[model samples]
Target: MAYNDNDGDFPGETSTAREELRAEAREVLCRLVGREDADFHPGQFEAIEALVADRRRALVVQRTGWGKSAVYFVASLLLRARGAGPTLIVSPLLALMRDQVSAAARAGVRAEAINSANATEWDQIRERLAADTVDVLLVSPERLNNPQFRDVQLPDLIRRTGMLVVDEAHCISDWGHDFRPDYRRIRDLIAQLPGAGDRRVPVLATTATANERVVQDVAEQLGVAGADGSGEVFVLRGPLARSSLRLGVLRMPSPASRLAWLLTHLGSLPGSGIVYALTVSAAEDTARALRDAGHEVVSYTGRTDPEQRAELEQALKDNRVKALVATSALGMGFDKPDLGFVVHLGAPSSPVAYYQQVGRAGRATDHADVLLLPGTEDREIWRYFATTSMPDEHRARAVLGELEAAGKPLSVPALETRVDLKRTPLELLLKVLAVDGAVERTQGGWQRTAQPWTYDGERYGRVAQARLAEEKLMLDYENTSGCRMEFLSHVLDDPEAAPCGRCDNCAGPWFPTGIDETAKGSASKALGRVGVPIEPRRSWPSGMDRLGVPLKGRIPEESQVAEGRAVARLTDLGWGGRLRTLFTITEGGVQDAPVEQDLLQGAVQVLASWEWAERPIAVVSVPSRSRPQLVGSFAEGIARIGRLPYLGSLELVDGGPRGESGGNSAFRLASVWRMFSVPEELASQLASARESGQHGPVLLIDDRTDSRWTLTEAGRVLRGAGASGVLPFVLALNG
Candidate 1:
């Protein structure tokens, strides 16, 4: 709650007018919060006054939990009382929209939202809006681009809208921590909004995390161009410090050690909160491990189903679980007032992102803990996300070319046939292009725009450079000996950045680094447990017939590989660090060293734990040009240990091609089609091995399985040669 503080007053206001406005705001705020004595924070009343009194555009850059939502809800009430139409809030996340709806109702404002998850309620909500019953309407930025919403409904809503609120306004700026292309459309929405005579519609943009640059960007976006082509924006910035949070960083030796520390210490933390992991696999793995350790926890990631995510959110709010092992999915718009702690299994690439996640804790509490368990692989993960999200000129141009050639709107799947990019990267590229005015989304799909589009090379370069700078700042944060809270505030360009006297640096390390040996053993054992099943590819790639490959439809069951085992995922808590190093490319290529004892032991454990119906009669290596030594030695060792014959390596013929790291299944299969061949000697050996024991399966060993094309093709050839079955065994599975 932004308590009514009188020290900061609205400028250019008479004492008499200020008092009257304050009294009115107090009554409304009380109703909104359901507290008779509810008060506004220092600048909250000024923001509300700007919207309700002056009808001006305002940007509120305050700390999280500073009641940014209150300004809008209260202002909407005042505006509605004056015969203004319903308030239209453009929120980013569905979770945030749900919370805003609930919050608005408490204030007695009839609020409703139309989102993907609640299609059944949209008609009812729209009818309510049409009937002048809804006082406030919450929508996602993505909704603004929907064909029906944009073309059919938005114009009428704009003409009648009382106020416009951009929640999490930082998203409108590319410099912000979480940038969404959908947010760029909000600028156009604001520009097209009906003005009140000479004044613009009262607009309020609120965000908890924004540096000076982001603030300026958002302010510029909020301001509409006037007849004279000039506009003014009012900004209210408050201190970014969270006094209740005690921040600290703990550098862990490995992923397992970090989990071990969490297992040993999570119970001792202040209260139920979030444990953030960098990737979905990490979150699910950590959550499973913690649950096995007898902690009540669940994993929340982008992959989680929508209804399940809602349930998980409520579960966490109810404190039914100790914590949610979550990715950034649980972030933004979540309103847990008494969250006790936030622990990061890995450091975010930017301090701004770090602040956003940690801000979730201690929102309404006297004290809360924020800890970052930094990992050595943090930089690698950062680079992966950065590079993948960055715009590629080549890909963007390719998308435009495909759209132009089609001469009509083409759905994403239809365009996939004409473009070389995968669905995810392709969709991202299209979104970037849409924001750049290169393409326009239509009812059918997306069509090329006649508006000239140029790749802003300089802008892209600057974004990339800014990301690297943020990474450097995060490193500085992790290694800083100064006040942790102050360090974060400085990175956010907080004007009042100073020691909070509550952080670990200011009060000395308040967290324990020690882990009990018993907990350590449990975490290690949990992590070391292997056997991620490799479900065989069910169907052949779609375009294989066009590529001169004699394959289509479902793969023949006789030729398909059986469900196999991997020592671990490259993103796993235990063997991930080691497997990553083994597969990592250097200046030349993978180091090409033999498999180490630890990994060998892990593979053996996988083999032992594997529940195979028929024991392997022979072992054959997938000939590796990159990791021949490792693959050969592993296969030979497995054969030696399991007492099976070494049936020799599959031949990698000269004319055949190998798949790259990532692509569509069709493209991947094309690259690896007929890539491996069974030599005559190897074929004879495989037949003999099969004949020796009622045609037992052959263990096909490889360095790693990325696309699984290599394993599939090898299995095809072996089964073609009369082998009963082929079982794939790999050192790691890449996601």
Candidate 2:
């Protein structure tokens, strides 16, 4: 049967021809899949039609099992018929790519995936691209980033490329649930692809969740103009209510009891499910215990090989494995629609991560359950990692001593030679130290975590305060006083407009009485009409600025002038406290003499490099605005520059030389520096480096206009000096 042309935009003969081709394609797909009608969601057909009709870019954000693949598949089929060249779909996971290839084969669409495991995959993919045999090509970001793939010689294929679809699009956002540096580069690669007659290929970016900032960032990075165009965007909300999924949280008094409870529950629960542990050892031990208890269980962690992962997935799919104990590695894109349950043996670091993992169950319409097991051990583990995992003074000093004694910067391998820990732990230590300003990593070697281990209690205090603030944000999400689902949706920017009634708090009564009942009782009592005082609805302030503690005024002018020379004097006098405590300079006559600004700045750099300060200020710019706004603007800029790894713990201040800001203020200039291993330290530095006359390569965030601002040569000099534990001050107007 010929399908009618839903719209008349396709012109006389072309319209008739395209309609005939679509019908043929549909028939072919149906026959290939051996189905009378494709089992697709209602919206799937509409999305496909929109994609084919519109010549511009588009994004489709739909729920997990809502046939997102079909939308792209149908579009590819239509594009091929229209003589468009191969379509490329960049996937975040290898398994997802394989699944799409399998689905396309079933639908009679010629598609293939280039992944790492297969030896001949790259060559075959390249051949297909060159021969124009592949209608659609699926690839993981890692595969696309491979130098071999980038240098592949093919005709101006991008110009003929019909569609570039990026799945799991949230990875483009730094604030997303899954943040990957490699994913951020996809935008540049897409932009480099040759477009139809100099016109960019119609790009389509899709994901389950894309917040406002994320959406903007993704569009900008991909150079897609905006969310609206011929390449428009459509967000399809999935049914949040999974009534068949039973949700329960168990609180155990001890870790041993929690383990025991896990064993007991696994034995009692019927059908296949997942037990999510926080660590590799936990997953292994839990699986072992479950097996000992006579339960059919498998385990998976980051260490699991691809072959094993495939086997485990197959076993789960075929119902051969009754239960699988896993870590976070098993959550993303492992689509087992018939998952019976998801049990968290320990508390997840964040609710967003927890929800995503639990949501994996019941994708195929079967009733599923989710269990959260929080025990003392779990809490202890969380607290320990939250507080102590990162680098500190002693650790930094040890690393520095080792490096100095060796008389050279240490490579990853050489550093491993000195450290007793495994590679992962060592990397984590290095990362934390880098963030703490204790170390600097070169292209091929590592420096000390910080300059030296000098205690500055005041500096540590500020760092501690910052850490506390961060902890509070996490705590607010975990608090049971409010609806968990509502809190999470609001925080994570989920587009669902209404409260999800499926979560534990929403499903169960929050209080003895309903909200209306409580309100009525309170209203009556307030009116003195014989009732109870209205139960106050608790509220927490939203936005980071509202909750952040304000910083004190910039360090004194004399202290700034004395800088490191004065600091060295004090250190020599044995006035060392916690690193955070040395914010002010003491006036002990000779000890208080202001040293050259350069010397003082150099000392400050030394302290910062030594990890004695929260951040190393290569340049400080004083702009006339609130610190919060400045921090936010800088973060946006960093994301734009594709420098997402250099953001953490930012502070903004309302300081600069009045309406007439200083011309040479380090705060007023733009400077570039490589953010080695320090993610958190970079965030703090960007935040704290906001003050008039502050020496270093910093920019004054002018509230008047939004444009690219540049830093002076002096500012660049300071950035260089700071590279060697010195601060340079420069200033420039907001030209």
**Tens-digit lDDT track for model 2 on 356-378?**
77777877765676777664344
Off by over 4 Å in 1: 1-7, 15-19, 196-199, 228-230, 541-552, 689-693
For candidate 2, the per-residue lDDT at 57 reads: 52
Instruction: Please list the C-alpha lDDT of all candidates, in the order they appear.
Output: 0.85, 0.51
User: Per-residue lDDT tens digits of candidate 1, residues 1-735?
Assistant: 121233366666477776887799889889888888778878888888878887888888889999999999999988898889999999988899888889888889899998999999889998899899999998998888788998999999999999999999998888777888889888888888766453458888999889989988988888876664334687888888998999998988988799999999999998899999988888988999899889999999999999999899999999999999999998998889999999999998889999999999998999999999999999977755555455788878878888898899998867765666788888877887887788888899999999888888888788878878999999999999999999999998887899999877888889999998988998888777787889899898665664567787898788899998888888776677678778778888678877788888888988998899888888988988777899989998898888888989988777566646676666777777777888999888866655665557889999888778888988988889878889999999986
Clashes of each: 5, 48
lDDT value for model 1: 0.85
TM-score of every prediction relative to native: 0.95, 0.55
Cα distance off (Å), candidate 1, residue 373: 1.9
Scored by lDDT, model 2 comes in at: 0.51
Q: Clash pairs of candidate 1?
A: 2-41, 3-40, 4-39, 4-40, 32-107
Looking at candidate 2, what is the lDDT of residue 669?
Answer: 20
